[model samples]
Every structure is written in C-alpha cells, then in structure tokens.
Target: MTRFQSPFVRVCWYLSLAILAVPFVFPFLWMLSGAVKSQTEIFAPTLTLLPETWHWENYAEVFSYQPFARQYFNSLYIACVVTAGTLFISSLAGYALARIRFAGSGLLLLLLISALMMPEEVTIIPNFFLMKWLGLMNTHMPLILLPMFGSQGVMATFLMRQYFTALPPELEEAARMDGLSRFGIFWKVALPLSRPALAAVGIITFLFSWNLFLEPLVFLSDIELFTLPLALSNFTDAYGLPLWHLQMAATSLAVVPILVVYIAAQRQIVESFALSGVKG
Candidate 1:
C-alpha cells in the first residue's frame, strides 16, 4: 500500500527475522535433542537433532539424585518471595523517586542509577564475608536478601520510578484530599496502574534470582539449601565431569518453563525489559 514498499523489502524483513530467531530457537532445539540423547551422543559437534529412542528416564534420574525436587522447590519459593518483595519495596522507592521532590531526590536517583551499572562480582566478596560473620551462610537468606537488595533490585526500582514519573500527579493529589496517606496513594492509586511495570520487574527479578549461581555457590554450603542453578552445576561424577543425562534433564527442566513463559508472553515480556532497561 505504500509507494516505497516492494517485494524485496518484505524478503529482507523475513530474512532478518529468521536470522534473529536462529540463536534463540537453535539452542533450545539442540538442548531438547541433547537432553533426549544417550550419553555417548551429547558432545557431537554436528548436532544430533533427534535420537532413535527417547529416554524420558533422564527427568526421573534428575529427581532421584540429591533431592532435586527439594532443590527445585527451594528455588521456586525463594524466587516467588523475592519477586513479591522486590515489587513492593521497589515500587515504594520508585514512587518516592518519581513523585516526591525532596531535597536529595536527585542525588538519591543518581546513586541508584549508578548502582545499576555496577556488577555484583565487585561486592560479592564483602557480601560473602558479611553473611559469614552474621552466621547466615549456607542458608537461603543470602540468596533471597542479596538479590532483593542488590543491582537487580535497583533495576526494578528504577523501572517503577520511570513508570510513576509519567503518571498524572492529579490522581495522587486527589487521593490525598480523600484522606489517603502518601503510602495509600502509592499502594492503592499508583501501584494499580503500574501492573505492567511491576510485572516486568517481577519476571526479570524472579528469573535472575532463580538462575543465580555465584551468590549461591559462595554463600550456601548445605546441600539441602542449594538453589536450582547451584544444584545443576553439582551434577558431577568422581572425576568431576558432568553427569550429562541428569544435567541435561535438569537444565531442560529449569530452562523449559521459563522459555515457555517467555514465548507465551513474548510481547509483554520484551516490552517490560525494554521499559526497565531504558528507565534503569
């Protein structure tokens, strides 16, 4: 319908999509194929796209080893708790940043934005020592608390702030006239309108917490308390080579659900990240 449009332009667009899709789709396809394959076939440079036999037992063995089910539950519940905590705390902080024109608000926002640029690796040493001194090591406390207060949390805060910045201040002022406290305006008025941003923060925070390995490995030592990512890496034999089948199966289990969610909500999910990234 446009004079500038042509068949060649359409071809180029489709080609670009196929190229972009390969890295995402290929890895998952290969992982699925690899997960089903017998041990001998795992490392083939030329991919084994499919195997003659499907070994569903890999999933079972993954659970049979080292209370995998419990580890999974640990990761799931912790992620949920952390996600909810972040949404509340971040939104509270973000709303204040966006709405309140306090004296040091600019400075506070600068510090928070600066934090987003800092890697967790730099603070891990200090955090690890703090956990050890507090006797919180080898527990889920570090896993939940560190991320809830760390860079990921800062990013979520910024996300909510950016969204709140764009909201009409009239609603907040009107609510205040109706006897709504500052907290009530945030919780009842602004937050309800911030579901998209909150959802984004929740999803990203949950995934980051769920897949977090370095913090868990550094802080948690108790086998019962290990998160899924930590548990995934622990699949090893006497020589320390990976137990391919169990690892693949667990990886598949860990990754597949997230991938499904990502695919199902690709638009919202991607938009959330974009909003967060730009704001953060």
Candidate 2:
C-alpha cells in the first residue's frame, strides 16, 4: 500500500493538519473564551484560554448597548438583497456576454473586466457625491445599490461568464429546438445548471455586504440604520476604549452567521471556485 493509504501515515497527516490549523483556529477559540471574560481578565498579562469568571451577561449587554438587534437585521437583510440582486443581474449579464453575439460585446466585457481593477476607495468619493445628489444619505440605499454594481458584482459577472462559457452548447441548442426563446432557454436550462457558480457568487456577495463598513459609514448617520460592523464599534467608552468583554461578545455573535454559512456551503464554495477557474 502507498504510504498515504497506511493508517499510521493517515493519522500523522491529520495530526500535522491539526497542528497547522492552530494559528488560524486559536483566535476564534480565544474570541469565544474572551467573550465571557471581564476587561481585567481580557487584558491580564497572563494568557488564559478559559475565563477565570464566566461573565455570560456580556452577551445580554450586547443587545442593551445599542440598537444591536436592528443592526444585525440590517446587515442580514442587506446581504440577502445584495446576494439575490448580484445573482440575478450577474447571471443575465454573464449569459449575454458568454453566449450572445453582438457588436461592442467584447468592448463591454473588457470594460467590465477593467472595472475589477478599480478599487472602491477610488470611486467612493464620486459615489458619495452621487448619493448625496439623489438625497440617499443616512439610508441603506447606497449600501444595497453600490455593491450590486461595484467590484463584487463585476467579479460575480466574470465568474458566471466563465462558468457559462464552459457549459455544453448542445443543451441550449436542444432547448431552442423545443420553441424556447433565449430567455426561456437561459431561465429554464442554463441557470439551473449553473448552481455552483451562483452559490459561489451569492455566498461571496452576501459576505461582502454583511461585513461592509465604508459605504455604511459614509451614507448612514442614523444609529437605527447601522449594520453590525458599525454597531460593533459602538461598544466603546466615551474615551474611545473598547468595552472588551461586550465587544468580544458582540463580535462572537456577529460572526455566527458567517461561520454557519461557511460551514454549510464550504464544499460548494471549493467546487465552484474549481469549476469557475477551468475556463479562465
């Protein structure tokens, strides 16, 4: 048997993986432990993985500290909208770019690709002015709209285009023979088959929107409209020092959805990346 197939080798390999994972995993373990620790304990010179005193009330204080629950909901709903919007818009655009022949299509694709290189920091000022002109300030509108058209959206389009470019043309041709219009073929045939790409885009867009900070900071001034990232910062003293216990607790809670999403869709994420990379 190959060395990799041997039980001893397998055990050693797994152990090596565990050892390698500690640096990445320990912060999360520390975060969980620190969530239940007091400020004094958290900043204590001695490194302790477990809390000397379990301050479970810090979790409750997370809600009482600000409009945290509303902020959480804001992040959640915005992420869902951005995810859905990116999927719908990106898929259609990707399909057209990948399969439909038209003048200037190549130029359009090139332009979109160029957009991927332009960081949001460069455009944030222009977008901020535009949103101000439209009277969208102190609202979630910018948060929802900007990302759907920005780098994340373009990346989704590129990924979808790549995936669609790699699909079997025979299936679409067969659908056309059945009296299916282009939209019908796309809606009925191509999209369903592109679930991996869609999932990848959806998950990515959702995460981006959920963790968004800059747009929300610029566009929103209302505490009630704050997303989790901003709200997390509010767990601070008037002197600007973080309430370590409460902040840790809030951060722990804020991270739960992300953890759940990554855990559930990790396999699909890896698969989607692999398939999307095949054509590009």
Candidate 3:
C-alpha cells in the first residue's frame, strides 16, 4: 500500500523544492533568453527576462562565425570514442579487481583511488610536455587518449568494480561448470547484468569528455581541430571580447545532448551509484 503525505507537508515540500531549484534553473533560463538578445539589450541596466527584439538569427550566426559544425562533430565523435574506450578498459580492469585473485590487487585499487584524489590540473603540465614530445599536440589524439586512460577512466573502473563485487559468485561458478571460459562468462553473463552501471559510466564519461576544456586548450592549437569547449571560447571579437548572443546560442546547442542524456538516464545513474555504494 502507498502512503500519501499530508496536504500541508506536501505544500511545504513543494515550496522548498521550488526554492532549491531556482539557482540551477535560472542560469539555463537566462542563457536561453540571452541567446536571443542583442549586446545592448543584454547589457541593459534594467534586468529583463525577455528580449525586446528576438534575434533568432544569432543561432544561424553561430555556424557562420566559425566551423561550428566541424567542432560539434569533433566533440561528439571524441566523446563517443572516449566513452567506448573507457567502458571496455574499465570493465575488464574492474572485473579483474573484483573477481580475480591476484597479488597486489589491493595495492593497485588503493593507488587508483589515490589517483582520483589528485586533480587533473596537477598533471596537466607534465602531460603537455609528454604530448609535445610524442608530437600529438595540435591534434584530437591527446583529447581522446588522455581522458580514456586518466582519472575519468579510473573512476569508471572503480564504479564497475563496486557493482561487479555485488554480484553473486555462484553465477560465474555455474558458467564455469558449463565450460565457459573466464572471458566468456564476463562477456555473456556479467556484462549483460551490468547495464545500469555501464549506463552511469557511459553518461559520466561522455559528459566529462564533452565538457573537457583544459586538455583541449593544452593539446590543440589549431582552431580547425578544436572541440566544442575550445571552440566556444573562439567566438570572440578582435579585442577578444565574447560575442555573447552567438556564444549563448552555441552553448545552448552544446548543452542539449548533455541535458537529454541526463534526463533520460538520471534514474539509472542514481540507482547505480546507490547500489555500488551499498554493495561496496
């Protein structure tokens, strides 16, 4: 049976939620409004939610001002590649850590968790030099390779490990009895049952790779090769001031995929994290 909250309590809960939601919602609303407003209207002394004149053309200008379509594709393809790579590498490593009996597994897991505590900024300088030596600068290679093997990958591996740890060992034993190889059990049984965790990891990795700025800025110098984040910053005047309207329009487009992914899989993400934490 379901229990319903009292009217007064429900009202108070709704009010509180509305208040809490304002900070997060306001920026998106402002960005949408700003995308259709001119510089003069945007900078007007009096704050207004709606533009006096709707410059819907700003969206069209976003493409005209740069190779936005190419940059968009760059971000999209890179994110997809990174997400795919992370899932494969992290799942194999995580399954090993959780299931395989090996010396130094504990130490390796500890070191990985420690690596998560270290911020990417700390390693950016060394990575920049490394990429330069490897001649991967001014290309998308660093953007794809770094995130696939870096902290984001580590986090995904940790999440997968926790989830895999929670599964019953009997399943694998049964598979083994059926003459399934270790990899066969993982590929057929374990992987199929781990959809929630995989979705969570995929969404997180894609967003991380999509919004990545520091890596792209460091590794890529060519505007033609820039990702969305780097390309967003290129929407500037001769004086390097942002052209706000077009920037906002481009940003609005950039955020659409993120919003769609989150909205669609928000429940899965929450459930996956909760399960992993409790099981761990």
lDDT of each: 0.85, 0.91, 0.91
lDDT of 2 by residue, 161-216 (tens): 99999999999999999999999999999999998889888888888999999898
Ranking by TM-score: 2, 3, 1
**Compared to the true structure, candidate 2 yields what TM-score?**
0.96
TM-score of 1: 0.90
Residue 38 lDDT, candidate 2, scale 0-100: 94
Q: What digit string (tens of lDDT, one per residue) describes model 3 on residues 1-280?
A: 1246577788899999999999999999999999999977889998998999999999999999999999999999999999999999999999999999899999999999898998999999999999999988898899988898899989999999998999999999999999999999999999999888898899889999999999988888788898999999899999999998889999999999999998998887677567557465
Model 1 CA lDDT for position 113: 89
Tell me model 1's lDDT, rounded to 2 decimals: 0.85
Candidate order by decreasing lDDT = 2, 3, 1
Segments in model 3 whose C-alpha atoms lie over 4 Å from true places? 1-5
The residue pairs that clash in candidate 2, if any, are none
Off by over 4 Å in 2: 1-5
Candidate 1 lDDT by residue in tens digits, 1-280: 6657788799899999999999989977777776777787776566568876788888888888888889999999998999999988999999999998899899998998899888889999999889989999878898889888999889888888989988887998899999998889988999999988887887888788888899888987888888899999888988999988778888988986587667776676787867754432
